[model samples]
Target: MENAKSKIKLGIYGIGLLMMGVIGISSSLSTIGAKFPEASQTMIQNLISIPCIVIIPTTIVVGKLMQTISKKNIALAGIIIFLIGGSAPAFMTSFTTILVMRGILGVGIGICQVVSTAIVADNFSGVEQQKVQGTLQASQMAGAAIMVFAGGWLTEVRWNYVFFVHLLAIISLILVAVMVPNTKPEKMTTTGDVQKTKLTSATWGWVIFMFILFISVQVYSISLSFLVTEKNLGTAADSGLGLAFFAIGGIIMGLLYGSLAKRTKNCAIAVGCLMLAVAYVVIAFAGSMIVCHIGSILVGMAVSAALPGIFINTGMSVDGFSAGMAISVVTCAQNFGQFCCPYIINPISASISGGRSVNFMCFIIGAVVAAALTILMLVWGVKKNRQVI
Candidate 1:
């Protein structure tokens, strides 16, 4: 376990923090339908989900382009696009136009998100790599907490004010220009050192597993406002607090993720998934907003605990040259889940509760599915340990 330390600038490592801000940007917008009574429920949901929809293809394309384009340039380009797309909503009155802008914003998020991790894989190795990966998730969670918490207050003022959160991307752009090192894509070598990294069955397994995990997680993303409305918990601002609580959990777990890894080894992912399952169940049955906040915290911590492991394990699964592609594939699958979760779950939710709030149904189903997977992960860990013994 030789820990190869990377000499990449510290600030460059922080660039990934901005990507998490995207979550915060749209979290409060979950209540947009309330603001514009003319908008359909589907249209209201799209304002939040549209960025994720566009992120899928853009992430894949950027991952491939990383083979030829400089990571720094790609990141810079993403920031500019993000700034434009995030800010345009404030000026436009048309919902269609805003959706289009969100799509453009997704492009920036997709490109930068992939490149951020690729940069880490390219520069760092071993324990430092794991530490940085944890830091990346932690940063995103922290950013989400700040932005979501603030956006909640702003939402109370005016829904349009929430769009201003995208202004944070300008700061990220400046950091990239000043901090990220300029370099070309890694060249393939004839020495086999640069051999293309292919995704193993394990990689695909994890990718599919994450896709399912997110279907459950999106319940929170799309249903938080509704949860508040149906339950009489409070205002959309209060729902924003629920999202913030979720981010805070992630922030706490992400900061501790490296240490947690030291103790849990491969079991961390299993435990994290189980925690999420329980958290969703708690949310499903919550009697008060306080109880809902508890659930949000658990979900956040579970995500923070699980995702860094996935990112680190996936990045390490391949050679440095191919890590970008592998990570991108993993990211693409996750975003696809985010993009489609509402559509997939919403109808099922409608039927199960007869068009009442679907959060409870979605949470219940997510818990069952995640619980099953957690058992499998635990069993797999046990067998692997026995074989080693």
Candidate 2:
């Protein structure tokens, strides 16, 4: 029993490490751009953008494969692929080849992202699941923080050295291989022996909600630096500090989620949305760096609370067989929403504000939408809990 518990703990750490794969290159974009001065800014930015695009489709495919393949094997494969693709850019001279490698890295991250969450759903339930999910998210935030700092430091030595951040996946590979069990996909069994694979209406509802929520919340991330600089409230470094506050807030919320879960219960999602609404309002009117950082923390806390709440709710709404696909669908919706946000929000903000304070306008718009979502979520939660009672 003690040995099994140790494996479970190590497996969680392995899953957490997998999240570091997607964000390894985020801080290296400027360094990479300086190396390839011939390439357009947009083309250079595609190093990050392209991976997000690839992850959308890759996640869907991995979701389907989970039903047939051993999840441990798939996770190991993903780690190997992640290590190769993420690190290969360090050696290559051609920009096109590096972009191709990033796409390959996306495939690996897609697999790891889906598998990590699905594994949590497969192994744990109720409060235990919520705690694990919270830790998983905390891991992602922590990993991203580590990679950003490490990548920045490495870039000082050599632009290419930044890519070495991915080599950390080797630790994940070892832990997962030794500690994670080779579990087959679970089937939803009934007394009649019929396998129920279809996700219910409620589960689909949460998926759609998560998609929309992502669209609204992501406005803060994409606009923060622009907003801070435009207002003359801070420099790029200060904006970076504000974002650090954001990560700190997320880590705090994630660690507290289990305790919060007991009190909030079904109302957790609504509370998170409501926090977001207030955060956007605070951010929109900020006249100083301190206020901006405060709002950033709120944004991070709100998302941390809301996203895990969604995952826990989704897991409870679906059966074991459907959980993998359900999570995949939600993950796809999230990425899709993030992809669409700039396109969707940019135009609206531009038109409404006549391009004046467009970034600030995004926060105002987000505030309004988040307020609406809070009410909607509250109603849904009340109804759902009533049905359970």
Best of the candidates, lDDT? 1
Cα deviation at 74, candidate 2, in Å, is: 1.0
Error of 1 at 34 (Å): 1.8
> Could you say which candidate leads in TM-score?
1
Tell me the deviation in Å of residue 36 in model 1.
2.6
lDDT string for model 1 (1-389, tens) is 12223324344444665676457654565567766788876678787688887888998899888998888889899888888888888788788888899899889888878988888887776776667777777777776777787788887888888877777776677778877777897566877465565777777877887788787777777777777787888787888888899988988897788898877777788888899899988988998889999999999998888887777778767666667888898888888888888788877877887654676787777788779878977887667556756
On residues 291-313, what C-alpha lDDT tens digit does candidate 2 reach at each position?
98899788777877888888777
lDDT of each: 0.78, 0.77
TM per candidate: 0.92, 0.86
lDDT of 1: 0.78
